[model samples]
Target chain A: MIKHDLVIVGGGPAGMAAAVAAYDSGVKDVVIIDRDASLGGILQQCIHNGFGLHKLGEELTGPEYASVYEKKVRERNITIYNDMMVTCLTADKIVTAQGSSGILKIQAKAVILAMGCRERSRGALNICGTRPAGIYSAGTAQKLMNCEGYSVGKKVVILGSGDIGLIMARRMTLEGAKVEAVCEIMPYSGGLTRNIVQCLEDYNIPLYLSHTVAEIHGQKRLEGVTIAQVDENRRIIENTKRFIACDTLLLSVGLIPENELTKEAGIPIDNITNGAIVDENRQTLVPGIFACGNVLQVHDLVDYVSDEAELAGNGAAQYILNGGCKGDSVCTEAGNGVRYVLPQRVNTGTGKDVSLFLRVTKPYGKVRFTVKSSENVLAKAVRIKAAPGEMEKITIKADLLNNITEPITVELEEV
Target chain B: MIKNITCIICPKGCSLTAEINEGIVCVNGNTCERGKQYATDECLNPTRTVTSMVRVSNKCNCMVSVKTVKPIPKGKIFETMELIRGAEVCAPVSIGDVILEDVFGTQVIATKNIDR
Candidate 1:
């Protein structure tokens, strides 16, 4: 058994950032375990720039930003086990991982969970189609093109208008492939507004809203696909059916936070985020175990992932040094148009101010975000517009929090 | 003079309009302050990310792709690429390693490692 001051699971943004932060924060012994042969995780395949805007304040590609942190980690002499899959995690912070080197057990003073996320595949969608060679996840297609240097197809039809799909549409075009059309089942696009402009509009790719692929036609490889507009009930409208000739199909349905290890550890999971329930400190219910990045919640930007991971890493270090945060605990709730709150529970008396991260339940214009205790508003911010595609954050002062004896609730109400 | 600018600072690509009146650049239509700067400075000089494939000298014969540690002026992209082509790296080389301390006085690194 290898014992260390801290053991971090997953070598993606969250894990890498956490390890770097912890190491920099005075934790000499830190180890990171990842199943992939290398670091960067999903970012490795995301070759397009637009990743490091907030974190690095520059337009960097996914691999570029990840490399920034990766360099810091390597320089710090952080031990990393690649090609290692963690199968089990314990409340006491013991982890069992299987790698090319065989089974490895790590006992640490603290642990950070940053396993990131996985793509939602066809099996999750119940799309009636035979498993064909030409069908690929948008992310998988991206990896093949950007990393493996293989063009997925010449003519392609993409299912779903998520960021991954939209980006892939542009990527395929850059590689000299024609994206026939991008179809989305939802009336509202799930991707950010800028993505629609830069990745789709600039390329003149048609977007079909409230539409879905009705049937996939092919025997050996994908020959074509039949698409149709859907009613609010989501049933394909027979009159709207159209056949699109294509050699490949890519699905960018959604992403699920990889939480099997969290579940195995008996930590509670959030149905909405599909990540472990964590506080501002990124500590889960299990003591000495913290979570961050996509493993905590799906973030739209890699910069935010690094920012959140820093908190988790510092929090874990604090726990090791002080034996954990102890004080009156207060609960946080999302009300009105708000979707959820991070740091679901707070150590009421901790002197540090709290930064609450949240998302709106729906799109709103001229809205005010209110963080209120039972009687008084702790903090508020007015925004000209807000959308579910963007995650919002607000800070509450510790001085104001000290006056609250009850749980705080955050809400987004339109003016 | 009026200048049209595209803010590539964040994923929110806010288009902006800039006018140089009385030697003071006034910008409008930006979503944030960064966009304002992006517009005002962009009119004087444009900047871009430098990304290209470089031959790995010590690792596998395959080419290892690279990018500037920081974005340089748009006009300097080809110059930066020229400097990178002459660079070589040794293995047990990890991804993100600084292959060149300062190419044209700007740090550049390998984003991925080529295994030997």
Candidate 2:
């Protein structure tokens, strides 16, 4: 069995950043394993700019941002096993990964789960249609167009208004494809406001909110699609159905965390995030096993993923160097207007400042997020606008965390 | 003349009104300082940072990603793309290497390293 101090399960941004952080933190023996031939995960497929503004303080494309981390790993001489998949991960941190050669077992002192996420397929959307040649996921289409020199179709209709779909609308337009429309079932867009403006508004692409595809028209290669408006109940209105002739239909409905390995490892997954449940350090209930990045929750920005993975990397390094950072942990709850919060539990006595990232249930205007204990109000941040599309962050100082005598609750207060 | 401009400073997408009186621009409805500057810039000379890929030969992957060293005029996007379409670079290109100099008075620099 090959032994390593730390084994990271994905060579994406999260895994690369974690490997670098762990190496810098005095944990020299580290390896990053990915199923792809190269590093940089989805970032490679993402060629658009507007990344790394927060972390690196400069606007960078997806590959540019990822290459910086990949360079850091190479400078540190971090070992990597590309084109390898972890078949099984035990609770005790025994990783069984298979590569092109054969199955390999590795006993890791700590494992960081950075497997990231995958796109929700057409089957998840429940659209009644024949399996055709023109249908593609937004990510798949992006990979095909960006990496491989292939365009999916000449005429496109996007079924979801997520970032990928919106970006693809512009990409297809730039590549000489006509995008008819972008339909979103949600009242508010699932993508960021900047994308809506730059991708759709700039291209004059119409975005139909509270609308969805009711039926598929073509038998083989997606000749057309029937889109209909939906009422408050999200049920399609019968008379509002309209057929749009398009050769391609891209689905950007949602992204689910790739957690088959974590589930197989028996880590407790949160229902809301569909990722592992852990404390402030991004550790799972299973000691020596930690999770971060999209495997923990879907972040609106890649910068947050790198930040969270650093926490997990430091946590793993601490586990190996000076045992684990364990203390009396307290639970955190999403009280009002909050859909869910990450780091479901926080150890009060760890004496480290903890940042709680959360998303609201609905869009609110002129609101303040209040983080409070039973008797004490910890901190609050006000915003002019708060939408489900944007993820909000609230930092709880270490001194406040040290004095936490009750379960903390985060509530949105209308100002 | 007052023009309604959407501030692209961040994702907030604040709608601002830029009123010009004797060429002294006054921006209103901005939530942040960057928004005010963005409004003034948008009203005066709108510029955008262009990011596109260039063909790389010597079998070093498919393409090398590049971006303008500074924001260029918004109208130069087509001209820039036209030039980038015909541009090609050799292998072992380093980040920040100027692939096309004097591109509309700005250089198109590589953003990432590509080696064979």
Q: Model 1 residue A322 lDDT?
A: 80
Provide the TM-score for each candidate, comma-separated.
Answer: 0.86, 0.95
Q: Which stretches of candidate 1 lie over 4 Å from their true place?
A: B1-8, B13-27, B33-63, B66-116
| Local accuracy of candidate 1 as per-residue lDDT tens digits, A1-415 | 9888899999988899999898888888899999998898888777667887777766677776778888899999899999999999988788999979799998899999999988888778776666667999999988776666566899999999889999898777655689999999988777877788667875689999999998888888889999999999899999999999999999989888999989988999887788888777999988889999998898888888999999999999888888778777788898999888887887776788989989888767779999999978999998767777778889999888775778889988889
Best by lDDT: 2
DockQ of each: 0.20, 0.48
Compared with the true structure, what per-residue lDDT tens digits does model 1 show for residues B32-116? 8878887777777656556554555564434455677776786666577667667766655555778777765577777665666
C-alpha lDDT score of every prediction, in listed order: 0.83, 0.87
Instruction: Show the colliding residue pairs in model 2.
Output: none
* Quality of candidate 2 docking, DockQ: 0.48
